[model samples]
Target: MTKFIIALAYKLETSIKYKRFKEFTYNLLENNSYPYKKHFDTAMIFLVLSTIGILIFEVNHKNLRILNDYELFAVIIFVIEYIGRLWISSDMHKIILDDYEKYQLLNKKYKITKSIKKIISKKVDFILSPMAIVDLLAILPYYRPLRLLRILLIFRLFKILRYANSLKEFLQVFKERKFELFTLGLLYITVVFFSSTVIFLYEGPEGVNPNIVDFFDAVYWSIITISTVGYGDVTPITIEGKLVTLVLVVSSFLVIAFGTSIITTGLSDRMEIIKENRVQSETSKMQDFVIVCGFGMMGRYFCEELLSIGKKFIIIDNDKEIVNSAKSLNYLAIHSDATNMQTLEMMGINKGANSVVALTNDDAVNLSIVLSARAINENIKIISRVNNGNSRKKFDIAGVNQTIIFNDVAAFVASEYLGQPVAFEAIDGILLNKDFDVIIDEVEILDNSKILGKDINLVDFKNYNLTLLGIINLSNMNNFIFNPTNINYTVQKDDILIIIGFKASISQLKSDLINLDFRV
Candidate 1:
């Protein structure tokens, strides 16, 4: 029978359908991004909470037939989840097949007993896990014959931790420092017991400290005194009792101080881990996201603009202080090497990263950033800040989509003010959206547009109070038709129009274009 079972296990191990079934089951239980996992979690949460609430309600109220039926349904669901988790917890077939393969390579007869032990070992490990233990206890209350098990219904609350990530992170801090906490717990227990024994022997109803009636009273007094909550109802009247109380109070302060230090330090480190994990998780779900490779002045301003436009973005910076500052403002910022190809990939380059801006103030870093981003996603747009003029060639060769030379732009702006101050101010005001009520925006021509194939001069830009700056040809973005006034430039699908107008006018024009409502 064991040989036949081993043969069956080996067959299942090579089965694609079996492997897929196991993978899907595991993902349903574990993967946060798995599609039905959310609904499963939500349903389990409702059922768990419902069962717990029903128990609490029945404490004072009578148990109705409807409530019992709901409770039974919830228990059945709990059992299903438990069995599913167990089934996916370990691959018994793989375990048996592995040892069999090892034995086959050795030219020895495979002992199915060894595989059985290994299979049992893994299943036992998972069953004994903390969360698994909680899951087991959660089911205990459903055993109607065991009335005592009903009190374990409170364990249902801990089951929610499986569905909640934040709680897991919060609890993990203590789990990491469990040894220190365990030591502290031992110390406290020893002190409390010793102090309670001393007080009970010295100050009791039979002794001078009469307020302490029994051993229970002595324990109460010891705890209250250690905790610094002396209510004066149970005072240590005797000299020996008072001295013991003094020492206990001092010990309490030390215990409190050490405990706080450990917890505080642990929490600080844990919070950093949690934040990084959160950043990664948030980045994974992002599509067509802009990755800002610095948290400097330019990067901050760019992030602000992106946020204002409701565009999704991820911030990467090597400077921890700058990253923290960004995080303080609730920005999704990660402290990482922007030049690292792995970091770019982690920031969703291989996924749907729309663009990457290398805004670090270093030319070399920005160049490396461009190269790394290009390597990860060749089609992704790479925008870089060129601090040095000589590095422009390197950036160009690295396939940077756009390069911004701050010094050159600033110098040109200064020169432009001298040549065309009024025009400069008007354009700057519209760009800034501060000195004027107008803004510059782009409108893309789609296939269904009413103005498609219409000449530039035919479209009345004055109706929308928009200044037609230029049209970027769909065939080539570099081909911009400047001052396209009364020319035979026909509008076509996918052509982008750069127009300066009010926010409302730009939105209205976009809406009109979408609805094909280009009416005077």
Candidate 2:
């Protein structure tokens, strides 16, 4: 019984360890798993590039012992990464659970052994997958006999294909135009063969010309003439051979031009499609992510605030240059009209979006976006930035939840700065201080929260180093109780708690308030 207990404890420990390991691997490797994935991918890219550089140096400097050592170090890192990935292959726990279920159907005596074998088989299948095969080849150079297989190490560079969206799009272009590319290949080959044969027939020893001796020489001369790389060494002495060369040269140019045009057109179309698909896929995976239409100064500032609060968001703008600028800063942005319903649908505004913020300089454009977003997602919160006060009524009529008037806000801020300089600076210090650890944020109390039915005065916010600034009752919409002295006030579901504290403490409190057992 003691032995059985120890075995059970060991199994529980291993299961916990496996869960942690899987989570870490998923965040490091999977897109949308974490916010810092770009940094991780960039670091891996540099590491791979360094390994490739070392391999190139090793090829030229055979006697350099340090190069060999560097290569070994790279190989060790690759091996560890490969092993970790294999251990946490997709649906690892599911596979084990499936095996356990099958074992339960068998005789009780053979359950443990059969379950073990089944689990091993599933893992072996994962190891034999195409990606796993490449990973194995990447580390095979460690073996003495397979040291020559180090040349295959170059293929390891292709591993980056998984991380690079552009490379994936390039490959997709080729895949989509495979038939056209094949036809082009066949045409080029046929032309080269026919030209080589005809040139040999016209300029061979039996012919009128004696310059070309063999079929290979004729073929070499044909290639040079057609490619416009005339060497003049194996020139056609006969008029017939020269005429044939001219025809081949012209045909080659036509074929080359045709092929180039086809590839260019195909790639352009495929790239656009890939970009759309990528945006759709990323947005679909996100829940409660904000959609910022018009990547102008206001939209940019909103994105900065959202990112500071660790929120996911996508920026949309009709200007390609602005879209590119946002992408340069690692923000997921697309160049497209926000006012169009099709564009809104493509951006997943009707799906997992928490809210839509229209911040275009043009009030008309922002109003159109607000209307379209509300039409698509009736429940989605629509916020519009208005330059004109008259636009606020139109936005409200279109079901916009809020409207920010730039002129009025600017005027208010300026007035406050002039009248209450000290108070303005104090608030600004908390809101804009670069090194300040604390800031004010709002957290909604969900129905399942432990403190939902409790009184505000009973809860010890000071224990968490957080101070309650106010609470906004969503049921009564505009009702806000700021620094309430009422000890009998009870917290209700969907009550927005405006709190000020360190970012970490605020995040923890928010997590506690919305403690729903859910998975991403």
Candidate 3:
């Protein structure tokens, strides 16, 4: 009894370990993370392609030893993968657990034997699943004693469909329109069968027509006429045969048109669903991504800058034309109202979004969007574009983290250019010049950063080829000390450090700061 108990405990502990292993394996196989999962997936893709190539070569050169060796190697890998999947089938454990709970509830007793049986039954069910069966069949060809089983190797190609997003979408389209497609297929078969029978009866051996000597000839002629190919290899020489041919040729166009219409409509609908699914998948995988709540001129400029900097973002616009324009530029865009809470939720603002920018050109709409976004995610950073000076206070009151006054900024630029043309031009050249090697950006200090309690002089910004501009203290939101005279000023938590440097230098500085545990 002690030995049995110890064995059971060990098995349970191993099962728990297997569950964790399954999760890790799933992430490695399915997720798009670089090097780890990506390397595995690439290797698997190469193996699959190699197997297919071997199969093709085997068909042409029947007894190639190299082909057999490659096939054996691929089959071994597939068999190992299949076994790993089965061993980590956590769903089977869930099924067994659920069944055991139900049994205890019904009988008011704990039966180890019954629970074990239930587990075995679930395992059997898993083995018989469609994918599992495919995995098993994919390996059967290696057992060459069954010569007929070699054909089952072709099914290995079907396994690739599991990893293909577009193929899955196509399969979904077919599934959704199966009934319509089935009806059209039936109609086509009926038309072909009836037309062939009538043509054969009218132009067969007893008939006046000599060209169509058999039923198959009449069938072939009907197919050709229906498709409007009109090979003209066989033609009716009698009035009855000609009349039947005319009716079939005319109805064939109608059938073809109807079928085309159904397919076109179904495909359009399925494509839309696929696009939405793709968007959702992308958004789900994103963390710390920006959300641009309009795709106007200002929004477009922001997206362009973000893209140049390699930042991930999604654009939401009410105008379909603007959304399409954004999409044309390869931006992830959704045609929806920026102020709607449901729209923000669908955009995953509460989940993985780092910031939300409202640039709708309407102060009221921007305010609403800011408020809505804050309600959904209190911690999310909110930035809005304010056209009117009066709306700036309203936006601040609505919890907007930042507001850009375009009119004021434009006026200031104009006045600065007029008063000090050379200085203004030099500044503009540095700020607006995309070709400039160095640029300025802000990096926020986190509470846990090593530089938090240290003075500015302690850290060597010059070492990284970065020039210290100033620091904006978050504690006093409006306090920005530019080019501070004091070199011993202590860096505080949540301080935004403004630094200017070359791209590589800035990247190195950012990495160093992040390594020291800076927030942004």
Candidate 4:
């Protein structure tokens, strides 16, 4: 039976109509970058709000019978959405086919039953997930009775949480801190139950103070007192009752303070996560961004220079305040330890990070960052700050491309990177002295560069007053054609051109390279 079902699923997946429909549905509901996803989300949001608004009106205001069709339509759409989420949550045909292929490769019989079980488990996992649960609850109102209507309608209102990213983030903050909140809740429940029981026993109809008529009344009084919302309706007259009331009042302060602290901590954590996520997304979009692994005075100055030069970079620091300060200037900075391997991975050192700059105060931390970044990407350029002269060799041994220290000089820009010999001292002297009009820089030949498919000698470097230092092919990192006079040294994509010239000349050269005419 499972074999037959798998075969049918394979056939369905192979059908072009089914494939196209599934692809479109998945893109509409699941793809963040899909152009029409915003439209789908907006429509869903409007439908949810409109249906909920109608439900509200049915409860109190005059009947708007004409809008009943829209409410029914919304419920149907909610049902479709729930099924769509379940469908896209896993590809059953792919799972079965993959398992079958793996078994064939392993020279073992295919476990058809096992693959069937896996598909069921995947579907069950999605159904049990929080968002799926919300989707189900939103649809449940359609099947519910009028008296139970409002309760289920609230869940339909919560349907907006799926369409809204901010509300999901807000929900995530509390979800991450559930354990702490749960611990506090246990304390609260204990106090409320104990006080309610005692007050009921002391001030019930049997007691001299009979204002607390029953257990229900005592429970109400307990909640009001503990929250410090005192009402004269259920006053405690007896001495025992008064003592319990005093204890409840004091307990409210502790609970309120503790809860406030927990929420504040969660918010801080969520904000940090949001900032890191933003940096990660930016890295995925940018191919040649630098990772600066410190935000100290030196690090800050280095980043400032990078910004002034129009270079893309992200900042990593253990200091929360420093990260916040960097963010204030609209820099892509994350509060993270640069020495951690996982943190370096998060910053995309292995992906497309062009280089890493470690400018931390501590020599050991800087060395650790160098080692971590090198471990992730051996070819990635790493420059570390060496405050102590003795620690310079340690950084070199860890495969740092360069070591720099800032005394009165603010920053170090590496002119020589990964053994492509452009004089470091010359560039350093230019920036440090701030007296030289000449500056050394590098420009990468992109796929769309005007000079691509042309010989290296085509564009006259002397015309721009820019000396062609060398061209490093990114693919062949070990090879550098220094001052290549060869006619065949053609301009190609991913070639880094190191040159020395004025800033304006370099910028103009870059602009020309991408445009149709780079002939200077």
lDDT of 1 by residue, 97-186 (tens): 888889989999988898889888888998999999999989877776866678999999999999877778888989899999999899
Give the 10-residue window scoring lowest on summed lDDT in candidate 3: 29-38
Pick by lDDT: 2 or 4, better one = 4
The residue-by-residue lDDT of candidate 3 on 388-462, one tens digit each, is 988899999899999999899899989999999999888878877988876788878876567777776766776
Model 2 agreement with the true structure over 105-185: per-residue lDDT tens digits: 874432455545666887898799877787777777667575577787786787777566677778877778889889988
Query: How do the residues 1-520 of candidate 4 rate in per-residue lDDT, one tens digit apiece?
Result: 7678768877987899988988999989976545577689899999988877787777777766678677788888888888888998888888888888799899998878898899999999998987788888788767866757557777876778777755777789788999999999999999889999999888885766667778988889988888888877889988998998988999989998999999999888787676576677676567788999889888888887788677999898999898889999999988888999998887778776899999988999998889888888889998988888877788889999988865423322332443443566555576656566677788889888888877888888888878888888877874788987454787778888888888888888999888866664
- Candidate 1 colliding pairs: none
Q: What would the TM-score be for candidate 2 when compared with the true structure?
A: 0.58
Backbone clashes for every candidate come to 0, 0, 0, 0
Candidate 1 vs candidate 4, TM-score winner = 1
RMSD of each: 3.9, 12.2, 6.8, 7.0
Q: How close is candidate 4 to the true structure, as a TM-score?
A: 0.67
Best-to-worst order by lDDT is 1, 4, 3, 2
Deviation from native of the Cα of residue 177 in model 3, angstroms = 2.0
Could you say which candidate leads in TM-score? Answer: 1
